[model samples]
Target: MELSILIVDDDKLLVDKLEETVQWEKIGISMVFTAYNIRQAQKLLEEFPIQFLLCDIDMPQGSGLELLEWIRDNQMEVECVFLSSYANFAYAQKALRLSAREYLLKPISNQDLEAVLSRIIEETREKRERRSAEEQNLGQQRKGKTEFWEDFFRNPSEQERMLAQVLEEGFYQETDVLILEVIKIFADDKDINYKKDLSLFNFVIRNITTEFFENNEQVMEAVAQVSDYEWVLVFRNLGEEERFLEASGDLKKHLNKILPQRSCMYIGETRPLKETAVGWKQIEIMEKKILPGTDGILCERDISEQDQMLSGNAAYRLPPWEIWQKTLHNSEDLDGVCRNICDFLKETFAKGVLTIENLERFLRELEQLVYCYLGEQQMSFSQLFDSREFDRRERDSFHSLDAAVGFVEWIFGTIKGRGNSRRSQEDVVSQVKDYIEGHLNEELSRGILAKMVYLSEDYVSKLFKNTTGMSLPGYIANRRMEKAKDYLEHSSLPVSRIAMEVGYSNFSYFSKTFRDFTGMTPNEYRNHMTKNSSDKK
Candidate 1:
């Protein structure tokens, strides 16, 4: 559990005091290093394998906060605790952003300092245990072909050279190696929630691969996380050029079938292993063109050397990602937005601007986005896209532009026709009712609800009664009562608090209303459920 500690502070006196006072050896801390600036600390890092860093927020040359930020940006693993004399909340907030373990005030306390160091020591021990476990896994990898592969990539010892020579003499001459580069975006930025996104990517890719190239085996593959936003998958498959091209259509179609939502992909052309770097560069170029929030399966043929040139330094390169994200965030009618995008694609194709590969890639990106939308809406894409039955509302949104433009015109004309009665009072009434039920704790008067839905109070009130056969207040109370009954039975919240939660300010009135509704007060309801449960037991 011994740890190497680095202290980065400008104060020589404090550094000497800390080094002398702290019982380093007894606590399993062997080495203590000091630096006044980030550059010096970095040099020290190279010289000594430091485990934890105690950094001062303010320094003469550079602050400790700056050093921590640099470390985080570079994906450095050393744990850091911030020490600052200035009582600045902003600095502390920034430190927290960098995931600093602890923030300490100036003139550090002996007890506080010791406690923090002890915690870091334990953490370092845990990290060592985890690394030890991984080392065992890596050791297993050193057996079989993986060892040879690792040696080929990591180092060039005599054994690695001998293996290469053997391969060159045997299967290397007969085998036609083609590299399949699968680039994944957003590999970093996952934070604690990366598993969800990673699982989705894995699930979609598995389905696509199975549906398309079922038996076609890939060889000598390499998959790496390129960045937080991307993944690069190099599939070295055992196949000739013709076989690869022949499977392309099925591959594209299967991707369409499997990933029917928004996700973009740029597939590079299959090339011989000698041209691996050339093929990989094509995928890399596509990455620069990939717009945020876009999902499509694209081929290398879809991109031109000219497109790359034009895409250079343009303010309006149309970040596929930004537009794709906006398409979901800005539009209430997601289907309409998607259809608009499709129509845009169709029009762009007519202009001969898009290659078949680019179009397919764009479609894949669209499919992933749509999948995300479906997930958010608690709907299944299969259920929505199934051929047997279709949702009329969503289907209607996909009409030709002529049809959509005409309808929009018709709606606009109709708005002009009865002094803009297109804003349906019924729509306002339904929206208000749903909104009130959602925000039950708020003071929801007819005036507030009307203003929210952009309608007159009188109009909203009349429409409310017309639709539900009750006044707005009565509807709210009934809904609140229903929710209260469920919470009362299941939750341990006090009856009085439950009353307030359900929008009843007066606990006595809530009890009376509860009794009136169910012939039992909130407390009585809870007791009845409890007694019934005991009887069942």
Candidate 2:
């Protein structure tokens, strides 16, 4: 494929020499375009579909830095290589800031120039393939129903224009864009892991894109990134200001669900995208004040509201543990202790940005304490609930706490109830043991015992194991083997019928367990018992 090169320099003689002597055609460069200043370069950028831009930093009209700034502002896809004569570190540093691909000092060597050209040639080949795929995406974009994000990355300029056009096609022809930034704050000690950060970026992006796609098919196009350990979700909105606010609130809820365990998200409010320069100006200011700045999606309103609430004061509150520990003594009131502990937890959740996991730890520890208290006094939460005999009106209050505290509290409470239930829970176990011994020929699962005792299969299984050191099946097998031996010694029952009399429908499983428990199988033991009985007779 033929390569195109654009050289921006005011040195007529040097340009002539480089143009004539170099085998540009041999290296695959076919057409070359020249621009003397930043103005001419801007015109060339708009008009010609040039591949490589080799520009001198010090130009007569305007420097290459100004041209680079323009490219960044317009979101243009271009790789720049800087050229300058004077040995200035500051200029090179500024060039690096602009993301210049390479820096070369001007008294240019043909060999170094050739090397740069070769590198550009290789890069352009890849760019050509990317450009081809981008064109295909552009074709898809014209269909109006394709995924906006896929096309958005390929042609950002076209996407911004299309979003504007679609909004015009819709209710409002004139609209302002709001750029909201979401920052996530992490634990201070550890540096952010990149892979995890990227995963978070993808997760939040999926949420934002899905939410927008669900609500507004036209105006709410968005993009997300993980930059400097912060997850940034940028949205393009052209709807009512109130609608955007509502969307921001919904997005925050969405963020909560994705990383409920560890991250706290702070969202900034939507600002005018038209004023992108000003919006960018606010980015540093916003970053300075944002909480949970590392992983959250925060709008401008989030930061401003927090600022107003704190009123420029650094908000530092005591940890829940320290607060609970202070002015503490051995208190016998279980209800008072539980309330104090729960209040401490609630305060931590509100003020300290506790993750869902840490909140769960607090609940678990609290429940463990409750269980220890109950066990010492021989009582249960269920008994307390049942004794209250809460009317239908008061029952709703339980549901409210159940919902607010979430499934963790319910589980912890249930575990505590199970621990209390065990002391008086063996009546059913005794009955079950009697029934199993009486009916050895019948199938004896935890389910059957549960039915007999009026309990769940799971509860009965746990209860049986907790009450008896041996498992139900193991105890039943041992009992059946003992009965079979008695029948063999005293009665003239056939070995098969004796096996049937014992709990062996298959007899093989029974024999295996019997042999495993004792030294012999059921048949072998029965034969020995019969021989001994015959000898005694």
Candidate 3:
């Protein structure tokens, strides 16, 4: 692959000299760009696919360390080398922390520069080639295994033939007991389009799983992608179920740390090769019955326990729809009604009778009750609540018991407002703003804010926008940036601390966001502001 490099320095002469003197092409750098400031360097990096960065540690506008921080924050894959006039240990330490390839003092010889550049280029090329080969091998293995399992599952009559094929492949023996595990990945962030990146995530997850089992005593026979977000792993001779469970717990923790998404593992029964299909079918059924929001490792025993609990309470029945409707119609206290609904749902869920089908039926009944109440008040549902909000609530209600209870509370809260005087839009927006200002250090999700005001997230966002002439996220970001600036200008707190004070957990992400907002890194901004303050004084 052809490589490119960018040289950044405040001294234009130094940058020009390097560009003219270095035999970049001989050092595997086919293209070279020179920038005299951090801003210009940032622009060049964004515009060109630069592979290497050689920057001076001290600059007038922004230091090379700050620029490197920005690059790392943006996840740019660039090998960096730092040039410094003074041999400052602190500067070298920070540079190394940011993954700089080398920290060389000023007046370095051309031979040394070429040697460093040549080494970085060779290392980068080898790393890329190794990754490419691994991905290719993983792709081939996945394709073959997926095809085999698809056919094996499809042609039940040819099971004996498939068994023979598996034996020939040495994946399993007739006497070996095999275990099947189904892993499902769930995206916690609503903004992440997981489906669009499932292929890449699948490859990563597969690699992690393979590496995990390689260290264990059990042999992983095969891995197959069963669906868009699901994979099935076949393990042979998985001795001692307790040991397997212990290892699975560790694996789940590792996956949670490394993967960008959450995963749940469902362990199937260990059966002989001839009964592998039956084991897969049983595990699939058990996985479907798992309650929403349930994660981590689940096994057949959990499902079996749930089934027993349900069978033990076979006579349990929910309250009649008429009774619930009557209670809703007569209740003058909205909070009381909400509390009653939540209590009932919680009790039912605890009893193991709140299946997905049961939850759907309950929601349908609640909807009818709501419509009847709205009609009696001479108000339409859409007039009282946005249709989009209602749809979102309904869709989210199926995800978890907490979501279902929240939906119910929102529904009743809206109904109560129809009978009473409603708060003005300005008042609601002001209330939300005050809360946000007071809680800048805490998580401020739309859902949490919506719950605080008994409004839907969509409704709250629209209301905030209508009142402030800015989107909800835009307002939050502005407030955060303003606060961050105040801290940087007046206080001596570290940038990472300021980031936490403004509700950001990841320091790198905070740096990126701050740069995008202010056009300078935190340190640069602090320096510039301090200099201006000194001049004014």
Candidate 4:
């Protein structure tokens, strides 16, 4: 997800060698992606944050130059260095036209590559700084009282400390604070898009609320934007509870005339300046308990009912996701574990014992835990989740308490689906592995291996890569070399015989492969093992 570099080449062997020899981490790059062709490289570019591309000029299916063209066409911000085997002036001219970092001839030295990369990294850093400066300039333009209020709630006491300076030029009663939670407001069918017309939405919420309460003789009111979706209004010198609440009821009627949601008046309890922030937090936390269509003015006193419900019973409370994670890890009791979780969720959401906020919070935490566990296996969550679109109904909010029950059950089913796919992948890889071990003395070409597993060569290759992060050829080579090492160390067989045993007819070629794999020739490895055995004796 962080900054990375991608290396694309049609020659898998060349790709392997380049990856093995490159000191990517030493050159301040921790992530380097490799692809055999342009399509795979394009997918990586879309999903991951790639800063640079070290791509060969020619590849199968699509060339690196074509990939560069696609990147430029998209106006994507990625620096590319072209690697070509030829010294064609036409290619050079095209590379220059595409604004490539450099057109490097094949067989460039590592030092030269490193030097080129260092320059690119410097340029990348400068590009990032320039972008950050531009964003900061825009942020400064947007910064004002709204930004101040957002910061104030995060560190309430500290911001309250700045009250004096803020009020030096302007005056207000900072004693009583009202935190208002704004949900969606649909104005009219054609002009009611909040996402597209966010400024208009913001204007209606703030400007209207300010005008409604500004000149009330009982209160000196000041409202400021707390977040994009919420605002805080501070009222001063307002005394009686009944009269204030009556005024609030009238205020709600006015708000309803212009807004969509009746719960827009979701207000916090009045508090002194020292305790006002506590009031703000209380209102937000209490909002989690408010059911849709069952609302009036919500006060701190309304929270006690939900608190009593949760504290009164274990099944009524939020599920502990960490415990579920442990259960999923050693999932002998998966059905029972999931069943219990779902039953409790049914009781919580279906019975209206938990608030929407808590339900969402719990579900989000559950998703995060699943993501963390899968990420450790080098699995992609978006790849797993986004590819499978949920039914449109599943995307909507729980309209009824019974619907909320169904929502929680659906979440467990989704997780189980992920687990099932993981199991299926393991089974496929396991069968292929069995074939590999049984046919170690025979040719294990991708074609041969794919037939053994009843899959096409390309399918087998992709499956192996997805499961083990190893190309079919790379994995087969690793297996062969591992067998060779074991034979050299533990058996009295000649190097030639051992090479043949590992399915290599040419002993010299086998020796070269062994050296490439382990940095030692077969005979040298045998000698080293004999010397070590003697020393041990």
Candidate 5:
């Protein structure tokens, strides 16, 4: 491939010197573009097929960091290196966050510049080559393997035929021992739309799983997305089971860091090629029995103990919902009532007697009690909680004991808040607004803010909207955009820095939000303010 590079610096002399001194053609750069400022750089970036960017961090109109942030927001894939005279750690940190290739000091020697360019060229080439290889491999081998597994799992009657065909095609051997590993993805965070992004998430997860096991010589791995949030990894040939388990633990940790959702991995026992279907079924059963938030690597033994405890145990019983309901109605001490419920749940969890069945029944009984109480007050559940959020919380409550307790507490607290006077309601809203104002630079979610004021997220959201004439999220976005505009007009901070100041870690998301709010990008907004100021002067 013909490689191209763009040189951006406000210093005309430095730009001229680098362009003249660097042997672009000798170092495999087929084209070189020069720009004096961020605007010029952005125009050239839009117009040309530049593969690499050699930019100065400091510029007059805008910093290179701002330009890179724009490039990222536009989804442009360009390798970048920053050149700065000062060894400022803040600048370096920003550059790193922007995925810059390297940070070099100014007055760079020709030899050093050439070496950096050559290394970048090689790395880019390798990446493209690897991507091409992956595409071809996916087209050829992965399709067949995935199709085979799908047939084997979905059509039990054809499992034998599929296995025979794969064995005949050398995809697997009769002598090989196979192990099935299943990864179940859960949308642990309320903000994640699991169904909407399941395909993309599955693709990324499959790639990560493939790469992690690529170096292992003991097993030949094949990964398939068998369901919306579940992936099945089939490992061929027998190896050290302990080693595989250790690696599975590491893979779980790696995935937890990289993936936005939580995942649980189940490793099935080794089986012959013919019994692969059975092994897959065993893992599926294990998955259904395990709780939602049960993360980490689970093995056959783990599932067996869980099955025994769930089926054989009869000592676990539901919480005393009838008495709790009477207490809630007769007592003015709502906090004490909530405390008692949480305490019971904590004690049950500590005893390890909290089975999923009993926990679910307890939740059902609690909901009934709450509904009956609300009916007595001529109020409905929908009036206090958003139906969708309520359903999500109920599903999440099944994940763990802590989650169940939290749901119970949130429910009772919400009911308590409903009985409060108008003045107290206004006070809660005031507290939430104050919290939002003070923590604009930190992450502010409805759940966090609601917890701070001891109310349900739905109740707080409705109160904020009723009091402020805007939804809670809408208010936060407006405040953030307003702060960003003030900074753009008054300070010389980079757009990325402004984004961080407004509680946005992602420059692209921040820019998109800003544009959505103001109908102009941050740079455009800043330029507009500048033009208006000049006109007034």
Candidate 6:
């Protein structure tokens, strides 16, 4: 993190100019030391912990190559850049042989110096991170819960010592870093349940990956559980890039079998041992990019390509979420709801700027809205459909705009099936009327009718009034009186017994109520009905 650079040139004025004009400190090189001769350069090298060496090839006393030889002999951790007035082949050959980072012919332009310094700084910084990663493997404690991750990213200088030592061990020389995000959906389950499952699942996947690499002698790996849902695996490719990919794909298959469609894996780009941080950064970026309707082994190349980005509704805007909610909330035809969702998803994919973050956020909020809407219908999503299954679809199911839209449609389709078990007030009001007429001998109240149709008492009253243009009690009483007249004319039963059958306990009250309903006494109406019947015969 705190790197120092040494500029050794026989030209004093050139050394001073190079030191003053170029800001070495900006590139993680905290200290810049200059020397006029090889003796002075060697003394500075011995005295300081310099990681980068910028030395003149043609120094007085001894050549820059000789000074480099001493550095190699001492096994010092220094990257070198050779400077000379001429592009001599012999000097260039010697510099290459000594593993110099860059060879700049003198009267070097500012652009050349800046380019060389920028490269060296990046190389040096990566060297530190690789060392830190190796130290993580050396029982020096890998970052717990990404605590060290934040610190390492925030300030590299704070972790220089162990990182430098880690690189010295030369652990991972050339490797590919794979970040596997185990995606799962648990319906009607708590966060505690998810946490428990994730822990067990992460362990199994880690074990599987380790065993996979161990079985192949061509590969070696270091696995870290960087977050609750993510695992970071750095493996030496050993010239088997395809093999690594195959193993990742196979691992995805295995995980899918165990966790169903809830599990997914993401793999980053393969990189050299020196650029470990680049692969890490790539993983961080690519993890946010899951292909729609995909569950496993999403490669960086798969999402980075424009073809993938343009695959789904990349041109149109979605109607507001509230519109979808209202449609699903009230629509009876399940097929219609699904079709509308499909059309909207197309538009959403095409019109909106889609990124993994915004897209996933949109899907999550939509799921919540669906849940709330279902609740208004008095339907429990957990009871009607597996929340666990849908939960996976909610999170792991998004990979493209088309896929996202399909997932939403599928969810609505399931809701329609459950909705079939429940009906509206308008549809069931006739059934309530039929029941009231058939049960005139018994007490028929709005509460009873509501229970028959699974609606509230107040709602049943309103529905009956709205449909029949009469109050529920008025309908019931009128039906009872009409039934009483039919019985009086058709049977020889006494008025009191007839009253009992028609749900009237008192004979006098029944007589009075019947008179009020039909504008005549029951006996009078019966006599009239008999006279009409005889005349028709």
lDDT of 6 by residue, 1-537 (tens): 577899988889999999998867666678899998888888988988888888888876889999998999989989999888878999999899989988888787876788878888897788889988896765344234234444433453554543344457653233433232323322223554766777676767567666766676533344555555555665554566677677667766676676633555556666554555555555555555434333434566555445444333343244476776676667645577568767755655454345565576667676687778778878655544444445656654554455576687777766665465466656677788789877877888766775566554666676689888999888888888888987898998988899988889889999999898888888888888889989999
> Poorest 10 consecutive residues of model 1 by lDDT?
388-397
> Model 2, 1-537: lDDT tens per residue?
566777888887776777777778877789888777778878988887776678888877888888888888977767788878977899889889988888898787887888887877777788878999996986565334324434533454575675565566672234556554444433222224546756655665556545654564434334434343344445566456566556655655665576422343444455554454345445544444323322244345444444532243444333354333332225443334445555554564455344333433444565455455556556554433321222221221122222324333433344444444454567767888899988998788765775565445655666688889778877887798888778867888876787788867776776676787668876788788778878999
TM match of model 5 to true structure: 0.55
Please report, as a residue range, the 10-residue window in candidate 5 with the lowest summed lDDT. 287-296
Off by over 4 Å in 6: 1-165, 172-199, 216-218, 289-293, 305-316, 320-332, 343-354, 364-393, 396-407, 423-537
How many pairs in model 6 have backbone atoms within 3 A of each other, for residues 3 or more apart or on separate chains, i.e. clashes?
17
In candidate 5, stretches whose alpha carbon ends up further than 4 angstroms from where it belongs are 1-139, 168-170, 188-196, 215-220, 292-296, 305-316, 326-359, 369-386, 399-537
Scored by lDDT, model 4 comes in at 0.67
The runs of at least 3 residues in candidate 3 whose Cα sits more than 4 Å from the true structure, single-residue gaps closed, are: 1-147, 150-161, 168-171, 187-192, 195-204, 214-216, 250-263, 289-298, 301-316, 320-353, 366-422, 429-454, 461-537
lDDT of each: 0.61, 0.59, 0.79, 0.67, 0.79, 0.67
Residue pairs whose backbone atoms clash in candidate 4:
none
Work out how many backbone clashes candidate 5 has. 0
The predicted structure with the larger TM-score, 3 or 4, is: 3
lDDT by residue (286-392, candidate 5, tens digit) is 55543433345668745444454435463656677777778767875678878988888777765655656667777777788878887876666765676666777
Put down candidate 1 lDDT per residue, 225-323, tens digits, no spaces: 344334444455545655654565455455546442223455677665555455655665555543311223556665566663225432221326557
Over the stretch 104-173, how does candidate 3's per-residue lDDT look in tens digits?
A: 9999998999998899899999999999999899778767766787677556678678888878888556
Winner of 1 and 4 under TM-score: 1
Compose the digit string of candidate 4's lDDT tens values, residues 22-109.
8887777878899998889999999988889999986669878799999999888899999899898988888889999899999988
How accurate locally is residue 245 in candidate 3, as Cα lDDT from 0 to 100? 79
